[model samples]
Target: MEAAVSCLAEHGWAGSTVAVVAERAGVSRGAAQHHFPTREDLFTAAVEYVAEERSTALRDLFHAGPAARPAVVEALVDLYTGTLFRAALQLWVAASNEEQLRPRVTELEARVGRETHRIAVELLGADESEPGVRETVQGLLDMARGLGLANVLTDDTARRARVVAQWSRIIDTTLA
Candidate 1:
């Protein structure tokens, strides 16, 4: 899946053939086929893998309180900086190029959004009626995604840290 991610990142959907993924994985085409018979299957698996990893990371981030929380939050922000976000962006681009991927990509994105919103609500201790709370959380997610894109394209560490700080402020304000 990592090989497929790298292939997708480098060549996009059209250029990332099973053979190319196999080559990148340093496995035989037959081996790759044994695991993922089709491009759609490979893409689906990759998306699932990334989502699972994010979920695990988020759970770990929230495992501790206060002292470790800030660092965990920063690590969470760093996770989105390039690696996982770039993989997801590649999938989004792939969906544009391949109709077969559109539905799954959209579904995964919605799931992530919903899950993140739930997390934000819990972290903020805010109820549904709270004004601006939902919007702030969603805005933070959007900003995080945008910063991820910028980080990938420009490798700008300062801007990435600024994004994290802005998000941290939202959390702080909401919890206060």
Candidate 2:
């Protein structure tokens, strides 16, 4: 899974072949094939694997007490702007034009999106039943995704930090 994620993050979807993943994993191609019969399976599994890892990390944060709004914002930013999101972006872009991978990617994305929404609500202490709270959570996610994309090709660290700080303030005022 790590190898697959690494491949996707570094090489994008077209370059993340099973053979390449196998080579990176220091495993035989047959072994990789035995576990993942197809590219779609491998990529889907990679997405799930990263999601599980992130979920575990978020679980810890969720139990760490009522996090400050800024802390929660920072955590969400870190989560979305990291390697996992980058690899997922690669898969999303590739799946856009690849008929064979679209269904699996779509399903995986939906599952992840739902789980992410749940986590964001929990982390932000936002009541989804409240008007605007759901949109707030989604807007934060969309902002983080956009920042992640910007970070892909440029040094957006300063800008990201500023945006996160400003957004955190807005969230505190809006959700308070």
TM-score of each: 0.81, 0.96
Q: How many backbone clashes does candidate 1 have?
A: 0
Compared with the true structure, the alpha-carbon lDDT of candidate 2 equals: 0.88
Kindly list the per-residue Cα lDDT of model 1 for residues 129-170, writing each as its tens digit.
778767766776676677777777677898677767766876
Candidate 1 TM-score, true structure as reference: 0.81
lDDT of 1: 0.71
Write model 2 residue lDDT over 61-100, tens digit each, in one string: 7696888989988888787777898899999999899898
